[model samples]
Target: MLWGKNIYRLSCISSGMSLFSNLMYISFIYSISAKNSDSDAQGLVHPIRDPRLLSGVRPGITSSQGTSLQGSYYLRNSYLRHNLKENQTGVPLFLTISVTDTNSCSPIENALVELWGANNHGLYSGFSKSGSPSSDCSSWLRGAMETDSEGLAKFETLYPGQEENRSLHLYAIIRTDWYEHSKNQTVDSDSSHNAAAIVQIFFPDSLNHQVLNRTDYKITGRQFVKNKQDFIFSSGQGVLKAKAELPKSSICGGVQAHVQISVDAHASQNITVTESPYQCKTNCKAYQNTTEQTTTISATSKHKPHFIPLAVIFFASTYVFYG
Candidate 1:
């Protein structure tokens, strides 16, 4: 009777231990998956009080011309302009924008997506302070395109250079309706009714450091602003940032960024264009002036740790206790 009781007690203890170990392993897996889902999931709404919008230039009446001098305004109605890689001075950037409706979380088709940013020297195409014509006549780094059925708008352009107070960024505007711009109207005009969302796109600081170190960017001698230091970026949280995948080989020399923007298509959020800290200064003549070194970063591999060790340990402990 005593030996039989010992066997029964051992069986119960082993069952309990097995159950506890299984629960612990399941909890660990759940926590990791939840964290990853939060990072990869889309649908975060971008804030409207973007300080960078203050420099938003109105699209010129013609595709070839830049913004008007009346004041800076967001570009619209420049659909004819595509492929913003005309000047191609810096590292190539392949940008893809995915537009989704905040209400239904469905992809929005035919949304007008306008993108504008600075060149290798940190100069905007239209604004004179950024090295464009005084009349704001050059439109090299600005273009507009409509989202396709999948709500994707792709742009082939150079990686944006940094400004004094601003990190490397690209400005984007999504509109559902087409509104005609008055000849004298500025971006400050009440055009929010038609605008779905006005936001800025950002890159990772690690990638920025790598790209800026290249000869094309190093010649500018301008200090780059990190995303953490930029008020506009910090204010938007992580919603406005794009996920960049750097090129692994010299043959594929450009980087690709993907971002999904969620907006209320029917509702108009007030997007006021206020003055920004970004100045219209030319690039600093200072240059790091080093031989361009190519550094390749391999894509991060996702290898799950082997869980067999845990099972083996559990079995060994069971055997020791039972024996």
Candidate 2:
């Protein structure tokens, strides 16, 4: 979702209050913005409810290289580059991506789901430095996971903070190798239960208000913008919407984001995976076997180190255990 050259501000829409399951309330989500897209709520598994699992996961990415990143590009092998701490800043966010066959609505197991989001202060891990975008790299909030037997992949992360004209959102890309096609390439006869789609999940105004106002998130002294002001939102139609079932007992509270992706069986060419936004190494194979039911992330190379300030580290530890 790049604008012009590098500006990738997606959109900021007031989250709709449409309720999903009884255990969950709508937070932020995509509205399947494609024309003639299916409106049916689709998923291949039961919603998540385990509190321990919900809180134990640590999600967030660090743009620590303190380098300026180009306007927009897809992050590669994101699952391994993040940390696994439970106490991250801002509101704790848990997300689940469900994959299913377009025809039967059956779950697509082992599908790789890659995710990346900016911290509460509007900086992305490994992509932004000292509050500005960078080409240098770091890792924490960026990562990936695979769908389980039930076609579900979940993560522990935080609510997205707004940047520039865009609203709070997370970037997602579902990758599968069954069929290959490009905008200029024709769809191969190859067919499989898998399909790939790029999506941006937005937040609810009610939730955005809560997260943005928190002392931890507000420390940046940033201004808030609405969906109407965001170009992607104002100009686009059929945005996808997501709902969450949050735990009420934790200090900052934990949430289970239940999101469903829709695929068109016949339109293999149209639904084929989009190219990764970031440039890949010559043979940039992912560090982990993306075909597993569940996967944890970590960096492969030990060199090319990045640094996080001690003050920020101290504040993070305090926020997680003492806040």
Q: Write the per-residue lDDT of candidate 1 for residues 1-323, one digit (tens) a residue.
A: 99999998888777768865775676578657654643422111111222212222232122111111112433322322458878557888889999888888888776667788878776665454443323344457777766777879999988888766778888877666432222211121222233445677889999888877777666445677799888767766323789999877851398989999986666543343332223222331110111111012111222122233456556655665564
Query: Which candidate's lDDT is highest?
Result: 1
Q: Which stretches of candidate 1 lie over 4 Å from their true place?
A: 1-79, 129-133, 179-194, 219-221, 237-239, 272-323
- Each model's lDDT: 0.57, 0.48
TM-score of each: 0.55, 0.52
**Stretches of candidate 2 exceeding 4 Å from the true structure:** 1-73, 80-88, 130-135, 178-195, 219-221, 235-238, 249-251, 265-323
Error in Å for residue 293 of model 1: 51
Tens-digit per-residue lDDT, 1-323, candidate 2: 34542332211111111112211211111122221122111111211222111111111222221122112544443433223223347777877778776877877665556677777777665545332333345545666665678878887778876675677777776544322112112111122222345566666666676677777677455577675665555545324457866566742775667788854322332233323344332322332123321112222222112334445544544454334
What's the CA error at residue 2 for candidate 1, in Å?
99
